[model samples]
Target chain A: MEMIERYIYAVTQKLPQSQREDIGIELRGLIEDMIEERVGDGEVKKKDVEEVLIELGSPREMAIKYRGTKRYLIGPELYDSFLIVLKIVLISMFAGLGIVFVIQIIIDPVEILDHFVGLIVTLVTAIPQVVGWVTLVFALVDYYGGVQTKDLGLDKTWHPSMLSAIPDPRRRIKRSEPIVGIIFYVIVMVFFAFSSNFFGVYVFNDGGFREVVPFLNEAAFSQYMPLVLLLLAIFIVKECLKLISGKWTMKLVGYTVIINLLGMMVVSFLITGDAFWNPEFMSDLVKSGIVTEGSEGYQIGETIWKNSTRIIVILLLVGLVWDTIEGFIKARKK
Target chain B: MNEQEHIDKLMLELRRGTITIGVLSQLSVPQYGYSLVTLLNEKGVQVEPGTLYPLLRRLEKQGLLESLWDTNEARPRKYYKLSKMGNEVYEQLCKEWEGMVASLDHLIHTRKDEEDGND
Candidate 1:
């Protein structure tokens, strides 16, 4: 009897919560029936229970049979999308790091070896982290989403009306668009987040070694780092929505408009801040002997430096408006 | 793989679908898990209780079978019977099975006739 109880416990323990009680009861009755039939009016013995359980097979095997399908961390349904996301992330990471490496080499050629080493180190460290985070997110989605592949077609509950209409070929999004958008946005994010110093003037020293004078004030830049990263994250999310939908819809357009406007507002605020530019950038260029003070080159450089933030703000606003209009056009295409 | 192993593998595949029909055929009359196993085996359809129990649950989940606990019995046994939907599905399944068997029988006999004529 104890053996029977233990066997029932073993099988039912692996099943879903709602099934546990009913299956446990059903298994107990079935085992008792098997035992009774095997004994045939003889004294109930432990050997009879052992034989019944042995015939039923191992507990894990029984549980699997009940489950019907093998469980996965990221099941077959999401596995394709997971692979696509991983590829895009890896390619983007490599491309971003590559661009930073080139810029560093150009800015300070003497430190090219150091820049190459830095790129390798970043790649080695970041690849695993990216893969881990992506895998964890996909696994979480698979677990909580409760999406079954059978629900799409195999199940009798699925109906013809549930099927989506054939999408217009002209309206269908090219996979490359979102792929490129993701790669581009990620590169931009990484540039601002980690390689902002690379965007500046390079000068030759007396020893013929190149040196850089970055334009953004490091102290002020650090303050806006969190918001910059958030906007970039939102941009990546917008691209992901496009990738998932594979075509522009009203929902996608709404999301795009909202995200672009939000980004525009944040960019405008960051650009208008006086601390966003390095105050000594112009002075540093002249002191480095690259340009003479009061010369035409100096005057031009100063004017561009002063209006740089305003120009950036205008460009960003224009980009945001264009994106919103494009989204509306694509989504409303007949 | 050896011929015997290959044949056994193919046999398992062949029996998989037919097992559902076998189980459903006997479930028109309410039967507990062990009773269905015994009845199927007696009628020359070998089924393990372990296989039958899970399959019964799945069928019930699919709305093909209705189950109730018969507590009036000496021991409380979960009895399963065909639902209204189950009956219609089972009948359709039977007709399909007959059609398949008839075509297969014709194919086998025709091949044998040609072989005999050659011999």
Candidate 2:
């Protein structure tokens, strides 16, 4: 009798609150009738009740039958899109972390082995956290019947005419390219912000490989950090847009041209300013016996180093103009 | 599968579709869940208590069956009977079943004649 009560409780608990009381009453009546039929003239016993309950099968299975079907964490309707979003998040996170680790190792060779293990552990832990959060968000969407693919305003609105809007094969930006670019720019921004000394040349001495020549004046670099960060932010946003569209559009090209121009202006301002490069770097080269002071080699090296900024600014401007023209040409192609 | 196993599987599938009509036909007279199972079993259609109870609840929910608790007895029992909608549905289902059975019978008989001619 106690077993029968427990069995009824198990089934009813799984049902909705509104139906539980009615179902419980009905189930108890049915079970008692079954026990009576089996008992016949004999006294009611635990074995008789056990036999009837076993014949009824497990409580969970019975509850499932009453409840209709099994539940899903992420149902089929949203499963594909959930996977796509998860892949994008995970791949970009890992790629960004990997590039940062590689750059850190290059900057500080002593901590190579230590940081490698730390990097792996970080990626391992971060992946599951990212995956779990993404899955939970999608599961909530699925539960609310919000996984309508048509309402997403992309695939559902596709038409034969839309084919003309597709970027030319040769001009199309691969998704991986933009993802890599975004990750690289993020690493560059973090590096320039925190570790200015890491951008110098490494020289092998009696001790070990050490950065003897600092390239950029740390104070001056710090002053321009805000501009550098803004440029990085713009680059990241542009790459993300490219990643989502999976191709170059005229709008994307316009954004690209604007970002490049802004970046060129920042670089030109930093280079043309007298405080950009470390004057000590050239003096350090003379002291290290790599070049003698006032020698032809020293003069040529300094001139090239000073004018290298101008050369780079010119080259970058040319590249930006060419890229803008290419974007327009691709947008106009059949 | 061997012959008996194959037949058992086929019979199970067939019985699944027929169980609703079988229970509905007998429920014209008031019967509790266990009583209905016993009645159907005695008539040679073995209805499991687990399957029958859930099905009765489902039918009651669908408005095809009406149930009441008979608490006058020493033990209370919930008795189910066919509703007016249930009776009409049952009659229609029976007519469809008869038409299907007649057509199948004729098809089988004609197949037997063709086999006899070939022999």
Candidate 3:
């Protein structure tokens, strides 16, 4: 039993504290009742009790039973949506932690943590705008499709029946995987075609960025075009492939593209004849009247972040978009 | 044509007749697809959800079963129960089943000696 207590505690932690003790009491009582039924009156053996609990499976599963309606697997949400969200959350979390490990190794651990704190500040600062835009798009699409909020499964406390007037197609689309793949391949090609020479339309010649935004010079404004186009391409490819295959090939492609960009950055660093951070390079530039007294390392670091972050976010967002498209396809199937 | 004979052949009769009756009887209390499976399981009578769900739909279309959603849950579960005509039919079936078993057993035993002589 001490093990059972720990198991129960582990599950109960997921519940609200006010209800935790009550739920724990009920669960314990239920377990006792189950045990009694299994190994009856005279005297209950400790080993028998453990065996019974073990047979009942994990604390997570039991907690799910008590906490939820019997909608396992996909639950109440769109099955694909839940899957996509789960994939994105797990992948992003792991990747973020991995990147942090690399950062910690290169810099003082404390400095790395400070950098993390700064990154969080950047994201938290952008959340409202991002969330608002996403919600707007979702709402617009919903209303456009005559999706009654009343019909939405989200409103119900438990999973609701999805009633649609449209008759379900008996036969689903059946095309060869490679043929569908060829179409996707074409879509990606088209995407690259659109984005390729478009960013080069005006090389570093946009002075529209007002001065208020911290890095809002003409050069930054010009950089935005290529970054935004690349982001768009990622999003589009992800969306298209999601429609084609239930998989997120965009991330696979995005990883390759990001690595390519990183390679280019590395090449550019070589061409610039410096690591961009080597002390000798900074000092040489400083002596050449290229650097001023106020040229702190932080600005250079920020510039690198500003440039590389767009690529990382774009790649990851490609994953998210692909997942989103898959969700749509799955939802459409349902 | 009596209770004793009917009791003796009850198993054979139930194997064919009791199944339909049992299925029809449960519908009196509104049950959704999976709940019906649980109910049967708990009662030591196992029915596959695959079979039960489709059967419920067919029975509903045949006018023996009526189904509607219970919207109180997050997922709307479809509930099914017997119609009034279904209840009447079920009661009539139960009586017919009891009478048939009595006759069947009496017929089989009475004709046994005649069959043996022919053999």
Find the candidate with the highest lDDT and give its number. Answer: 1
Error of 1 at A6 (Å): 5.9
Per-candidate TM-score against the hidden true structure:
0.80, 0.58, 0.28
* DockQ list for all candidates: 0.80, 0.45, 0.05
Candidate 3 similarity to native, TM-score: 0.28
Candidate 1, residue A122: lDDT: 85
Error of 2 at A33 (Å): 1.8
Model 2: how far residue B103 lies from native, Å: 4.7
Q: Model 3 residue A99 lDDT? A: 49
Query: Model 3 Cα displacement at A277 (Å)?
Result: 28
In model 3, what is the error at residue B114, expressed in angstroms?
Answer: 23
Q: What is the per-residue lDDT of model 2 for residues A1-334, given as tens digits with 9 covering 90 to 100?
A: 6788899999999999998987788788878878878888789999999988999999998888787753778776567656666666666676667766876775577899988987888777877876776677667656654444434544766777755545568668776776677667656654665557657666656765544567778877788888877777676656655664566677778777887778778877877788877878788877766789999999997998778756766887787678677766875565
> Candidate 1 chain A: minimum summed lDDT over ten consecutive residues — where?
A144-153
- Candidate 2 Cα misplacement greater than 4 A, ranges: A86-93, A146-334, B1-13, B102-119
Clashing pairs in 3: A157-B74, A158-B74, A158-B75, A159-B74, A159-B75, A159-B76, A160-B74, A160-B75, A160-B76, A161-B76
**For model 2, what is the alpha-carbon lDDT of residue B84?**
97
For model 3 chain A, the run of ten residues with the poorest summed lDDT: A208-217
Arrange candidates by TM-score, highest first: which order? 1, 2, 3
RMSD of each: 4.2, 9.5, 18.2
